[model samples]
Target: MNKPTLLFTAALLTAPALLALTACQPSGPVTNAPETNANSVTTLPISELPLHAEQATRLDNNLWLGVHPHGDIQIRDGQGALVGQQPVAAEFISQRRDAQGDFFLSLTTDNQLMFYRASAQGISDLHLSAELPWPLEGMCLYQPSAQELNLFVMDESAIAHQLLLTRTQGELLAREIRQFPLPPLAEYCVVDDSTDQLFVSEENIGVWSYNARAESEVLRKPVDLVKPWGALEHNTGPLAISQGQLLVAELGSDLLHAYPLDGGDTRTWQLAPIAAGQPLAADALTVSADSDKTVMAVLDDNNGKVYRAELTLPARAGDNQRIVQVAPVAETRPMRKSGDAADDPAIWVNQQQPELSRIIGTNKKYGLYVYDLAGNELQELVVGRVNNVDVRQGFSLKGQAADIAAASQRDRKAIALFSIDPLNGQVSTAGEVVTTLDNVYGLCMYRNITDNRFFVFINDQDGRFEQYEITDSSAGWRGKKVREFAVKSQPEGCAADDRQQRLFIGEEDVAVWTLSADAGAPTDMTQVAAVSDVLVADIEGMDIYRSDTEAYLVVSSQGNDSYVLYQAEAPYEYVGRFRVGINAEKGIDGASETDGLTVTSQALGADYPAGMLVVQDGRNLLPDENQNFKTISWDSIRAVVIAP
Candidate 1:
């Protein structure tokens, strides 16, 4: 296949004009002045925030929280008022504050450490601390001695999947001071100075603690926090130490559990529900002491709002603590085609009737195939390259009131809309080619239910997106030019959350982008979560799945043979990453690569049925070697979740 030359030609022809347009715009209008006062009690309406909030910590009296929605760190007072916000830098995905009142942020993007000291003047203290040898996820301040301000960071070293504790005391830095390798899929970790303990939370398997000063010590035996609760749900959340007791935030039940370190007593408190209509997906939390009151800072992920609640610890009796759902503000599916060999998938579903899904997938050397939800390969369409496909239903022209419905069905029957022989996988061109798409790697389908029209979005490797509208069709299907948008990097895989009017685009080395629908452009983009060092090669496919208020964005790492799953935090939250283990049959151990990924509710029905993740195994083919695709069921995935 020829590398898309048409897109390069279009860029060459339009570069100068675009440069001139950019040059004409003013750039000095923005300044670094503090936008809001430290005590400013500004309340960001819920509509402007993220969908879920994860990872909440107390930075002295002022609480700092991280949200997955937009990957922003928000600062609030003890009274729970939005004081300031800062978009996390590209290098970091997680952050924690130290005892010296310095925010220790984990720069997972670049495998470095950042220190942001928040003063009364807001985020005026930002410093680039020491860089780590490997990427890290969880971080906390380890104050072993009062005179030293040492930071402990957790590194995801694949060798043993251990947490490399890097201690830094000014110029004296020790890399890999201590290593704690736990079972795979470890959730949250915290260094408790009060008890001199390090608590690590594992999924299904409860909490484990070890001496902070020990080099390689076994945890204080294991505690099975979750019992055999059948196949309904799983437990995952953050762990912290409060008043010599270990506090575990159960995300599955939205409950904060308090277990005594001395094995004295156990108490569970239900967090207050957020305000009416507000979604509550708590990621991480921290409890703060205020002379007379015990306050807790919770990341309200639903709307990307941070909330502070008053905590009343039990004095002597077995009474439970009360938690009130406080107010927080926050931010912020498929189709296919036909081909015997489904290469790429493009989905089209009516906005009003999303259940009526239509998919267009490529057959590579053969042609395209159309399919319904029932796995019935309907028809096949043909096109050049046929590397990717996109479908749009009920498209309208600027001046045409044509019968598109009758035309769509008729075209399917005549095999004239595009061209494909379902039996033999051959292309018979009937429709004329529109604008040539350059290195088209990703595709999306957008349908306007109000107007009953649709637009097809194609991501070209030349850093541009082409949009085409299905036009008036009497003989078959005809496409018309709609619009085009510029991107910074080559787009790999993309998924659109039409219900939320947002599009998630995965680029090469860059972090994902969340674009708005009204402007048909990106409003905010941040580099938060990435797939280890493998992302440097490229990110391939992405899919968006939403269940009521919760949303998930799964991205495929074409270079690493893994998949990175992100939970939409207050605007979105970066749930921890889950890597699919390659099996012997898949030949992942060989030089084979894992490419495209599609997640649906289909797998939730069999054993897992909560939801299923389907990955494409790209096996290496020698000059005479041939291989077929292998599927990993959700049951196998759940094993990875529990596999140490």
Candidate 2:
């Protein structure tokens, strides 16, 4: 977050109606629902079948119990009145959902871990996903998404290893299994699901956070998220997360403890204290905090008794823990190159299916990479010497509307073209063409929606800029000379406002300038951001983000390691500036000396449901590892600079 550091004469720009997205809420696996199917395959209604509560979970307005022995599940209202139930073999039953918001059940059998497509009627499509690689003496499944799950499965050898399980079905059933080492004493586990974070309670050690998305070696086990929670060597029971608070059953003592999700100061209460044999053995715990009703249920395993009580977290939560709770969530992985710089990122929004959208980024020394919102690389294009990359859609070529991406190839002194598959979201080479400018350095493309034309701007080391109007020819794509101009100094970052047909260029050593997008039009070499003023020298990346009534031009002020924002309209006015700081919890460093960056206002997925800002980290140090891109949620940006 940042404030305007400079004063200007311009009046306050018009405010925009920042329409909140109503389509999204706390409605994932973390939220509440009235009734849910708890079966992998069709059998019979759980209510009609005779079954007992093996494990109880709180859903929307009711409590769901895993009716085992026959593997059925039942739902009961707040007053302990039976409402609905379903019969299916769901032992370790947990409610999950696919990208479409369709409910599913994360199930575990004697020898298999699986999921079942569920509906109000019943459950079907039993995906017997993964077989027991090693005998799971103990296991915990945290389903944050259909494909993203953190699993702690321990073998009889007393060695615990966390596995990230993934499953996708279509043309073929694709399954992936990656293992992460965990503490040997790790026992019970609980998931926030909203974030891919898990809380594991060690029998001897304190509770720890298990994040498989750590920014280390691809499949390496992540270190502690915040810090090891609770007193060391304390025996703790199960865990339940509700309203940013973690409820714990203290097995070592006759008490229940609650702590802020960040493992800050905690509060405890006695539960069956000083009883006869075992003073209230709390071996299992479940709390319904995602719904209107607040209740907690715990199992006294040694006493063979289950108790339900009202649950309320202390109102005294420290501001520090609150800050950690609101910090953005991210997933960082290694780039293709172990020592290369992570430069530039482009966000592609798949309207039909948001989950399929890809984040295209350049692995400077390796090639271009395509990744999902989870930061998992889906594809990599080994094009050589690629510097800056830009993408556009709805370009009709060969009688078909195509999505084209272009990158500046420094090795060949040319611009390389690639086509993207809309369905599968893959990148393939279209053609290669040389640039008109010599020693091409910076590159960006603009597509005019009104005229259905593509214009690419390329600049060189000598301050010469070339704007080319691209069109598909009978043989291949060709560029026609539009207009050539020279700035006062060398330039790099460049972007165009397609709706306004205005081109803004960044002269690295001078400042930002704007001109007309039309060829042969009058040039406006006006300095929008001067060096040493609102902006610093060596501006590296520039991109435009638009809301309903406002647009912002963001430029990387590499000198200060921050980004300056401005109103994208004519007579461009300054907005504010912000620097992406380090995230020690996820083991990620912020952007510094950013080469290129991209932003999208389109809600990509849960991670970026309100949109996101991705920047290139030129100096990814701290732990001394290869550079990697860092993604920040637009909500975090809007809270400071963009919000009214």
Candidate 3:
């Protein structure tokens, strides 16, 4: 309940300092200043096409496909000669082509999206390969790799959706991964794949740019604006990225503006006149870039005429952020409650049959959930409002050897305990021990390899932490406060390396710290990692993955929906970052906005021979159900991100 206040305080206290530094940087405004070689472009008139197409996309240097207003497509050569036609039977409001020359068109009526293959043979080869449902005003495609295709779409209400499409088993699977707000009256959008940036035009406002990656933050930077705001003469129109520049068309000015992707002076070009000194009212535009030359096509919507011109493009280096993508193998059934109810997850390995291990997760709003390895809900313990949970094995409970799981119960401000039956994999509540903290938040358990003693560490929302040693008694399980400490800010996640006697604690907006796990040891701490580009702010859950040879530390970079890894030893060398993507074949959506994750290196089965990773999915999509947890095999991640 106090989470909102903590977040607000962090932002309020940090905004001034952040803004002060931003103010000192030069304002790289989008200006009307032309490039050094302003008048070196040649303009020529192409033929007037016979078809009154609303929009057109150039397939190559010589082929163009025009979308007609009457629900048909006309294929024409560069000379305006019609080659073939196809009746699409749907009124498409927007169209875009990917790097592979495939076309994606969207219709507003049924909220339908259609896909077609591009072919140089003729329109006969333009067969519908796939279709999905989405409501949008305009859309553009971004291809990060040959196996991944991203679609950025804008709706009439000015909402943008980033959909990830993956090809699997001869089918294209789509998942809506992220959504954010946009200015009203926005119509056109384009993505610069090289930079992973999206540019949108807010009809009467201006052109703005946004980070296009699904894992990036939702922020808008001004590219250009209308008259008084920037250098553009009219409202923004069509948008395209070609030859290291963002080409923006002015709605009614018959002028084209080019802004370098890397901040530079803007260049303006006047389209060839349609008649004797009459400017063409450009509406739609497209550009084709190749090694030989760059071709530009502009459509005069008023007269239904298409004009073509050629220009030279300046050379610039490409800058791209590389993010590794891995798919989830399975996902648990969604929780009964909705809206951020799922917060943390823990894995309980079954000694009898490793394949039968269970994944324990906290509903936070309801209770604890137990799931089988196949992601089926095995049991639901309706304990009230448990925020975080962890498990430790070989604990003596009620005169029997059992696995113990501990969670911070916010409703009672206490530690909730459960005993897992190792043989049958059954979890039963043991007891709850009350704490003095105002609000109990994060919890983790540790077992001493030296003395075989079990203890649990719990932190309050105000940064106070307490360590308790679990003791078995005639009454039941109880905890004695052994040691206490505090961080400068709120800390939610703490993982103990029992073997190294080291404990890792995450201070939400600051950094990850380490200290001795020994009760009598000094409270001195060392900085493991700080919040940076790799480890985004609001660092949430973290756990250690121990292989036979080494141990790797995985921390959730919650701000950007990515996970960062480090060597979990002295020096703590940084590994790589990766994101869980949609598994097209299994129909399981990716995990994002994660709050807690747990990893184990015990070989579970054939699917998880190297170990498994289970994470809480804050935003579960694929049918838009309640939140759930996803499972990813560590072997798959090692194959892509870990070097041999």
Best-fitting candidate, scored by lDDT: 3
Which residue pairs in candidate 3 have backbone atoms (N, alpha carbon, C) closer than 3 angstroms, thus clashing?
Answer: none
**lDDT per residue (tens digit) for residues 1-644 in model 3:** 11111010111214454344234422233334333234743354554554446666666546777675555666777676777666664433233455545554534233445555434666532323254454567888876444457788787767788787655454445578667877777778888776667888877656777777664556666676565545667668988888778888888657787888776667777777778878788777777775655676678867867667676778656543566778889999999997778899999999879999999999999999999988999999999999999999988787778889999999999999999998877999999988889999998988897888999999998999999999887777999999999999899988988888888999999999989988888889889999997898889999989877979889998887888888899788888888887775576777777899999999999889999999888767675678899999999889777962
lDDT at residue 246 of model 1 (Cα atoms): 63
Higher-TM-score candidate of 1 and 2:
2
Candidate 3: residue 433 lDDT (0-100): 85
Q: Give lDDT for model 1.
A: 0.45
True lDDT of residue 637, candidate 1? 40
User: After superposition, which runs of candidate 2 have C-alpha atoms over 4 Å from their true positions?
Assistant: 1-328, 338-340
- Name the runs in model 1 displaced over 4 angstroms: 1-343, 346-360, 369-382, 390-433, 436-439, 449-452, 471-476, 519-536, 569-571, 579-592, 602-611, 620-644
Ranking of all candidate structures by their TM-score, best first: 3, 2, 1
Model 2, position 279, has a per-residue lDDT of: 58
Question: In candidate 1, what residue range of length 10 has the lowest lDDT sum?
Answer: 323-332
- Compared with the true structure, what per-residue lDDT tens digits does model 1 show for residues 222-241? 43334331111236467665
